[model samples]
Target chain A: MEAFVTLDAVAVPLPLPNIDTDQIIPARYLSRPREVNHADFLFHDARRVPATDEQNPEFPLNREAWREAKIIVAGKNFACGSSREAAVWALFDAGFRCAIAPSFGDIFRNNGTKNGLLPVVLPAEVVEDILAQLEASPGAHIHVDLPKQEVTAPDGSTHGFEIDPFAKHCMLNGLDDFGVTAAYEDDIAAFERRYGRENRI
Target chain B: MSEPSGPRTLFEKIWSRHRVTEREDGQTLLYVGRHLLHDGGATAFDVLRQRGLKPRAPDRIFATPDHYVSTAGRKLAEIEDPRHREMVEKLARNTAEHGIRMFGLGDPNQGIVHVMGPETGLSQPGLLIVCGDSHTSTHGAVGALAFGIGSTEVAHVLATQTLWQRKPKTMRITVDGTLGPQVTGKDVILAIIARIGAAGATGHVIEYAGSAIRGLSMEGRLTLCNMSIEAGGRAGMVAPDETTYAYLHGRPYAPQGAEWDQAVMHWRELPSDAGAVFDTEVSLDGSAIQPMVTWGNSPEDALPIDAAVPDPESAADAERRAQMRRMLDYMGLVPGTPLTDIAIDRVFIGSCTNSRIEDLRAAAAVADGRKVAEGVLAWVVPGSEPVKRQAEAEGLHEVFRRAGFEWREPGCSMCLGTNGDIARPGQRVASTSNRNFMGRQGPGARTHLLSPAMAAAAAVTGRFADVRRLVGG
Candidate 1:
């Protein structure tokens, strides 16, 4: 995992609400290992024409101006369907450092934190404003600062957001969650021994 | 663990029972009672091997190969694709290396993880369960606090047998009165999702209550809880009752002798206390819910069978109208067409949601003595080996075959189209799976979600027919 402090990059807007994980990375590609670069699988179906296997020019990611976007502005309940972590890996592997939505699927938000990608939740109106600004300026850059918990729009407007403190700490430092939980192994083993006697499973 | 002072909901009782410690940052470490795994979880094992970590509690873990296994037969050779075959073999090798119990192919207990968990009595009341797949909530029907986790969390549970968590708020959905005939638990859940949008239960664990919910059999409750993720719920659970006990009484892994009595006593106290409060309350009239079928890409796009495809012009706002138009275009549906008039190219009656014997019986009853319509293909894939055996003994397979429906082996076939059991592109399907997302069946495949009986009706009629009409509600 890479440490996150601040990033300034071009952002693209995907205005569809309830965009699910199946749309992010279809289930067919799920069997592949994490070592595989998942950027090719991200939106594999939606990025092509269904009838002819041709590149879909209408999709935002396919547009010339948004091809290098590092941030995604989406509608409510983004990534709302499955708990597949591959969805986050696809986005992160695609060079997206941040995702801004009015709300998000709980599991997706958790998955995002573990990876290097930052999931930023803002008010619906604020997200709409940022999306509109990005759409008006296709190559506009939106600035995200993790320590300040703020997002700066292209139009020079700033908005504040909230994240769990522990999550924030992990994001600020590129800490492996396994190491952190392993530190409490003693306490966990003690609890298990006592619980085993009481539950008698 | 110290008992908290105050009345508690079912979720609270389980959460406190599993709590090991809490940090000031609101992250609590909860002990996992059971860790279920499937073929898709092979990467998690690779992560563990890479880190040189052993499973903290191998005895508490169980696994089965479902996601990528072929439904044509119970052999590795049956899985033609090398990528899919490697995944199934890896699960067996990984479980063997770790000394964890895996119901691999050819085992009588082999099946989808969710169905195999409850059927084998590995899932019980007041337990904390986690799985890598999102449909792990299906175990919550037994009164356990089960939810899906990501790959990293899967690795976390395997290494430490503990996970960090923030407690979710509780929502109680009460469906009062008795459900009318032909209105199955699948319909009730679909109705619930339609009432509350797809993300209505996000960040909340839902507790299903009231007469109608309690009346459902254990299998029905599993079906209802299975789709909690479709509504964006962290988990869904029902209070254990006589039905839950009966279902687990003599299963392979269930408690026996004195332990059985003790377990029942504990489960008896697992329901919410009288007058216990919830963060949210939602009520529905059970008798009013009709058989449902989804017309759009999202599970929340469901509508009663009698309703027509909605017109974009009637949408409440501009954004909604645009979304509706896209859905209509993708589904190849015309506005104002009666849902019953929508034709389907294929019918799939399986998946974790509706593959139990009860679901098979429902579909078999409808398909009795009726031939499938011309040009429409239908398949009945059982959920597990046990379900397949039971269905065979009851002659349900013969009924389906006699009705011109293909009877197949057990696995997740055509649900997500990962096992080479996908519909052709542009094929419209009436499916009994939980999700109806775009391309969920296959690329450019349009899926309509419905109950098993409704799917059978569609198979016979060559269109989306109302189940109530055939079953005589």
Candidate 2:
């Protein structure tokens, strides 16, 4: 995992709510191995014309000015269905370092933390403001600073956010689950010695 | 701070027992009592290889092939798609190499990972279970604190057998009174999702209680918990009782003799304490819930079978109205169309949600003497090999077969459009599976989520018909 301290990049606005994991990376793409790059499949169904196989110009992601956006501004309950981690992997592979929404699906948010892709939860009004700003100026930059737990808008106004401190620690240090668990190896071994006796296996 | 008052809820008791250590940030490391894996386990294995890490306790992990395996009665070697075949083969090889117990294609225990867990007694009362599949909450029927985790968490559990977590707040959803004759667990859950919007249980673990929940069979209980994730719950639980004990006794993985007695003694005390308080509470009248079905794109877009499609103009808010309009557009449904009048192209009676023996039996009862309508195609794919064998023994397979329903092998067929078993594009289906998201069944496929009996009714009638009306109850 790469450490994420701060990111300053263009923000893309997608205001639709309840954007589920199926839409993020459909189940069809999931059959392929994890090594396969899934960015192309992100919103594959929504982005393409069913009859012509042409890219839908109306979709936000297809807009030329927003093509290089690295932060996604979305509506409430983003990534709401299925516990697919590939959703996060696809967004990361597509160069998105952060996603701002009013809320996120429980498992998808957890998956984001593990993969070093930040899911920023803001007030609905704040998210709407950001979306409006991004819509007004597609290449406007948003600054996310993990240590400060703040997001700075293009106008230089800053907004504070809350994140799980441990998650923040892990992200700052580039510590994946293995690295975090390795810190308590001795305790884990002790637990095995004590509980392994009665286990079914 | 003063000592807390009132009795602890079942969630509290289980959570405390599993807590290994608490970090300063309010996150605790909880030991996983059991870990279940499926074809997706390959990703975790790949991560392990990349990190050069060995599983801390291979014995604690169990693997199976479900998601990508073909459910067309073909042998594993005959799987046509090399990618799907590779997924199952990779899981088999990885489980074998890592010394993890695997229930492969031909194994009697092999089935949907969630079904295999409890049916095999690998899920026990008061245990913390985690699986790669979202429907893992199904094991919570046994009073376990079980929830789904991502592939990265799978790798973490493989390495440490523990997950770092922040404890979720608790909600108690109490369904009162007895269910009407035609209503099933699927109806109860759908009703709850309808009552509370999709994100109602967000950030909370739900404990289902009260008379109606208690009256359900183990299969019914599993069905209830299986859809808890649809309501955005982190986990869903029911306290262990005589029913749970009876279901587990003598199963291959359950405790034996004296140990079983001791385990039972502990489980008997696992119910929520009399005065336990929940962070949130919601209640429903079981008798009022009819055989329910989803009309729009979300699981929460549900109504009783007799209800008409809701008009977008009647929505409480603009956002909701817009959402309804989009859902209606994607489903190809008119606002006033009666749910029972909508025709379906296919009927899928399978998936982790409703592929158990009881589910199959319910569908079989509906299909016993009735012929499937001419234009409709129906399939009954059992949850596991054991479920398939049991259904065959009971002549349920013959009943379905004679009724023009396909009796297929055990896997997640037609649930999420994998393994070459998908509804054709532009087709509409009556599905017992969870989720009705666009393209969930197949690209451009419209799904009307319903119970197994209701799905069977649609199969026989060529349209959505209320199960109560079809069964003449």
Per-model TM-score of chain B: 0.99, 0.98
Candidate 1 docking band: medium
Model 1: what TM-score for its first chain?
Answer: 0.97
lDDT of 2 by residue, B127-166 (tens): 8999987889899999999999999999889888999999
Off by over 4 Å in 1: B1-3
DockQ of 1: 0.79
Interface RMSD of 1: 1.0
Cα lDDT for residue A10, candidate 1: 92
lDDT tens per residue, model 1, B1-473: 45767889999999999999988888999999999999998878888989999898999999999889888888899899999999999999999999999999999999989999999999999999999988988999999999999998899899999999988899999999999888899999999999998889998999999999999999889999999998889899999999999999989889999899999999999999987899999999999999999999999999999999999999887767988999899999999999988989999999999999999999999999898999999999999999999999999999999999999888888999888899988899999999999889999899999999999999999999987788786
Q: For model 2, what is the alpha-carbon lDDT of residue B232?
A: 89
CAPRI grade of model 2 = medium
* Alpha carbon RMSD to native, model 1: 1.0
Question: How much lDDT does each candidate structure score?
Answer: 0.92, 0.89
Instruction: Report clash pairs, candidate 2.
Output: none
